[model samples]
Target chain A: RAEAKLIDGKAIAADVREEVRVGVAQMKEKIGKVPGLAVVLVGERKDSQTYVNAKKKACAEAGIDSFGTDLPGDATEEEVLKVVADYNADPNVHGILVQLPMPDHIDEERVLGAISYEKDVDGFHPLNTGRLAQRGREPLFVPCTPRGCIELLERSGIEIAGKEAVVVGRSNVVGIPAAMLLQRRDATVTIVHSRTPNSEEIVRRADIVIAACGRMEMVKGSWLKPGAAVIDVGINAKDDPSKKLGYRLVGDADFESCKEVAGAITPVPGGVGPMTIAILLKNTMEGAMRAYGMM
Target chain B: RAEAKLIDGKAIAADVREEVRVGVAQMKEKIGKVPGLAVVLVGERKDSQTYVNAKKKACAEAGIDSFGTDLPGDATEEEVLKVVADYNADPNVHGILVQLPMPDHIDEERVLGAISYEKDVDGFHPLNTGRLAQRGREPLFVPCTPRGCIELLERSGIEIAGKEAVVVGRSNVVGIPAAMLLQRRDATVTIVHSRTPNSEEIVRRADIVIAACGRMEMVKGSWLKPGAAVIDVGINAKDDPSKKLGYRLVGDADFESCKEVAGAITPVPGGVGPMTIAILLKNTMEGAMRAYGMM
Candidate 1:
């Protein structure tokens, strides 16, 4: 069998960002202000800072106005909610995201719930989650990662309806929503996670396998169905002395072996990594459109 | 191998109903009104009538007041909503259930949503559904069948946490919520449904398998893990010439064969059948408790 073709998520993400840029431009011309995203980052986690920076950069690149608020580790939950409330009242800030893993003293749910559903760009609100899960109801914004995964597949012209799709994670963030989205497209979707014994056997029968569990190299080439499409959502840092950071980004699937048997596969670092920011930009643009009744 | 034990759901349900009777008696004394359920049956479908009668009988035996509204085949959507509004306002009625598969003319969602979340005994309301799915949020009522499945296992002394659970259906009512309930209990849950190509292989690895796809005998004995616990949620009507009705209720599993392999298994008609009403009664009591601030 020929080696599987690589699914270039980075390239597709760039195209998506370009489309979002145009959409934002159009919305700004009609609505008097560019779409704005307010990102609230608490504490000083390096990874969180990196993600926040990337998001702000993407907004600027898309010509969408962006705002950031950083609070020290000692900041109270009330202070964070204050920032959220401020954005909720600001018509200019169409999207709001609170960086994850808030300080230990904070009531995460209450703070997350404080954001208006219209401004919940992360799509973590129970209302949006419900809309996505239920039939016939449409979520105002699909979560970025799941939306990005589906966008990549749609751009590839892969048929989703009635296909055997396997999602190898069950995280509230990715796996559950991903399965729901796939089912919406009419694919038979199964979710397998750490507790799933014989997961390899299950994955082998799928025409589409999505690896989102953060276990590096858990899914091997032998687990792939011949010509199956693989979407790797894991971004684990593996020790690599050769790198300046002394670490390398690896996906849930072993790229070396899986690419040989899979019809198409995504690479870590360059795969799902790029699409997240692009979808965030898309969501921001859509938020602007919806705020103006353009959807 | 030792012959697996058969979990007699008929006996289990009887016990559950008896327990609910005591609870209802206590509530009636304290609240001055017996917990009441309003069952809205749409159309003249015989199977629906049978199910409604079963629910009513169970409610009666448990000392819960029951009322039925059987609309004709030609009832308008507004007609259903009117009854829902009536129940919503009725102080005595603690639970309201609209039988599933309403006629094609009626907008099902609008009808279901018409019932107030407080009176949504069937737990189909989007608010309740969202509550159930959200991590920290708990619904006032859980859908009956899934709750029944869990109640049966727990009453049988089957441990769920840290077990490998495989759910063989992904329906909104049964499979999905069941998986969520199990996951909340710390079970490693995998949902395998129509999209799962090698479901048998996946099922064989599960410490517990829940069959809810409503397909008769779809799960073979070979699909069961050695000494696994099995709960069959399917209620398929199969031809039975010996029966007066010319049909019999069979579960999603091949019971005889599965009993040989499974450590514990619930029978088709007796397994999950009785527990659904039991849980419904339980939910009504809880709803009343909440409404009265006694919980």
Candidate 2:
């Protein structure tokens, strides 16, 4: 059995970051200012904080200004909305990202909708999401995770057009967008979810499989077509006494066995994780360029 | 082979029209005004003119006021846009429908985008189109043709959720929206386009197949899963010396052969055609109710 070649999302993310850094530098020199991203956090979730810190750190390394607001866990939705409105009016803020898992009392949709579409680099805006589903009308920004998945496939020299791609989820942020993106690239796409019967039978015939259902290793070895390229986007915490945290992140794909037959596979934590932050930086830079009328 | 049940779209459309008529009278009594749909036709293309007339007649039968504008064949893009703006502001106009395939001279997208989404009966605007693809959020209007296809299945009492739906096209107008609508109803969906390889292989697995690829009789009997319910949205003109105009209408599905293996199916010309007009009337009435704060 052939061990599938691992797609090194880390190295690719590094390359993307380097390119964005260069672009940011040139934009700063030409426009007299650096690109800035403002990430608004409402709740005090530890994971959300960790993600925000990583985003701000990447922005700093890439020559982008990082601005953030840490609101109290019980902050009113109005308070959080006020912060978004402030950023929307700020000339220095090129992009606005409201970290998800907002306070339970807050209306997340209302807050995300309030961000100016021009500054909606997070690409969660309904209008931006709509643009991605549309052809010919360019979206302001593609959602980072799905964008990262496409980047992985392209950067790894995989052919997307005319391929049979199976997406095992129908989520707005990941699965739906990935299916739409693949279809845009001319791939014949299918979306199978919990409602789907014979999901395994359908998945077994795919040329490319994206497991993003968020279930832990629900897709097994037999679901793959021999030599098919697999991209696993799920990150679930599984108990692992061998790990320092007592739990380790595992992807939706059973990576150990899937890799045995897959032509190419991406590993759990390092695969899609780094690419997401990298693309966020890239989107911020693009947003800044569009804002400056620099293409 | 067992013959399939023919879905009676004409009779169903008549029923829908009657229901809309009753709704229109009740709204008139309550609000002192009926729903009004303004159809803006950019040029004098015969087919476009024919469609506009059909729509106006349908509106009249349903007790909805129908206003129309007929610009010259060579009207400038700005001229068409000005009319659209006028209708958008008119208090009486609850729905604004710009007849499609506007003279090649006009920018169709620009014109469609200018229509207020609230009055966008055609549902071609980027925002409305995006809303259709999304989950949780609702689109202001579903494109009539796609909406009609789902109506056919529902009226026929076919189950959508947990079924295998194959939509054979990706046109934003019909195919893509239809796929999204079925998926929203909990059916697993696969979309196949001209770029797809082995489309027949994929279509063969459908529990419900929607043929909208605009190819005459492209799908044959061999592609059907046993007892599949099929909705044909394609209307192609085929060369036929027997007809006065020397051409006849055909759907994407090979009806004679496909019906033999399917449990139910819709015919060309009378099937999706009447339903589109019926749905348009329904949408306009609903739009008026929403605008009038009656809903």
Candidate 3:
């Protein structure tokens, strides 16, 4: 059997970022303004800080302004909500994103709901999510990771309409939204989550498979249909004495084995990870355009 | 093969209506108040009028107060929105239902969006729909027909968890919400729509099938898996000289053939149709209870 072609999410994401960069420049030339993203971090979690820094760096590289608000872990829900309200009213901020997994003291839904749906770049607001799920309606912004997954397929010239697609997992962030997006594209989409039985048998029948259950290498090559297109969204740390970091990142699907049978696949580290921030930039730009009546 | 047991939606709906009647009576005795539903009608469409009358009659039977607003066909968009705003502020009105397909001049989305999500018993508001689609979030109200379909399944003691359920069609009111509802119940759900190339083959793999495509007798016995439970939401009119009205109502499934192959199924006129109004009353009652702190 021929080896599967790599989906090259890194390159596709770079292309997306470049497009946003150009769009940002055009907006600057036309309106004398640049799109701005306001990111609110509630706690001092190391992982959240790292993600915030990466997003700010990406904004700088793309010629978009970035605003940051760091709150204490013990911040009151009202305090956090005030920050969101401030950002919501700031004309300079085209997008507002609240970093997730805040301290147990805060209500995430209340905080996310506080962000204006117009500037909800993370697309975590129920209004944006509902619009995305409904037919004849369009969300102002799609959740970044799921949008990136669809971008990978469309950029790779993979057909979605009328195809059988299976999404493994039902997380609100990635799996559920990804399934909804695929269904919107006219694919016969099925979602198999942790509670699902016979998931492997269901997956083997798909023309396109999205593995996002957060389990490391759970989808083996034997579980895939021959010539299926696979996109692995999971990034789990696996112990590897051979690496300097003492652990290596792997996806939900075993790439080495899956690449031999699948017609196309995306690898872990450089795949969906890069695309998320790129799509965030795109969403920010779009938000700015819509605000300025330039869309 | 044994014939499939009929899912008696009329009897179940009667039970639900009785429950609502008792609840309404209790509320009246406890607080000297009854649930009130405001029905808004614009234009003179015969079908819309018929539906509105049926809804009011149902409310009366359930011991709930009914409110009505009738407007000319040429009513302005602002007029419709003003009516919704009035109902939103009315403490007596717990649920506001705007009859659909208003004159082409009025924007339906704008009118629907104007209703407070709390009083949106129709569940057509994007926020409610979005909440329904999201995991761990709850909608104040779910759309009537789709909710009815689930009520039938639950009342019939069908296990939804860990099952392979297929939803046919993707309409905003029925198909999309129904699919989301099924997925919420932990069913591995597949949605096959008009654009799907092999819908029949896909439907054949389901343990539970919800046919809502509005196509008459489109799903044949051959298209179903043996013993698969079927809920036919489609109610199409077919000419029949033998019938008193010179026409007869049939579902999306071929009843004779499907009954022989299926484990359980809902009939056309006596099935999902009755449950829709029943659920509406239930939702209205729940909304009133929430307002009174009874729930």
Q: What is the lDDT of residue B124 in candidate 2?
A: 85
List per-prediction Cα lDDT, in the order shown: 0.86, 0.91, 0.94
The most accurate candidate by TM-score is: 3
Better of 2 and 3 by DockQ: 3
TM-score: model 2, chain A: 0.97
What digit string (tens of lDDT, one per residue) describes model 2 on residues A1-295? 7799899989999999999999999988887888999999887899999999999999999999999999999999889989999999998999999999887788877888899989998788877877788766778898999999999999999999999999999888899999999999999999999989888998998988999999999888888999999999999999999999999999999998899989999999889878999999999999999889998
TM-score of each: 0.83, 0.97, 0.99
- Model 2 segments more than 4 A misplaced: A74-78, B73-78
User: Per-residue lDDT tens digits of candidate 1, residues A1-295?
Assistant: 6888878998999999999988888876886778899999999999899999989988999999999899998899889999999999998899999999888999887887788989989988766887787766888878899889998888888878768788998777898888888978878676776766568877986889999988888999999889999999998989999999999989999999999999888898788889999999899888988888898
Candidate 1: the clashing residue pairs are A188-B195
RMSD of candidate 3 to true structure, Å: 0.9
Please list the Cα RMSD from the true structure of every candidate, rounded to 1 decimal place: 4.1, 1.6, 0.9
Clashes of each: 1, 0, 1
- lDDT tens readout by residue for model 3, A81-165: 9999999999999999999989998989889888999999999998899889988888898999999999998998889998999
Q: By DockQ thresholds, what CAPRI class is model 1?
A: acceptable
Q: Give the 10-residue window scoring lowest on summed lDDT in candidate 3 chain A.
A: A130-139
DockQ of each: 0.31, 0.75, 0.89
Which residue pairs show backbone clashes in model 2? none
Task: Let me know the DockQ for model 2.
Answer: 0.75
Best by lDDT: 3
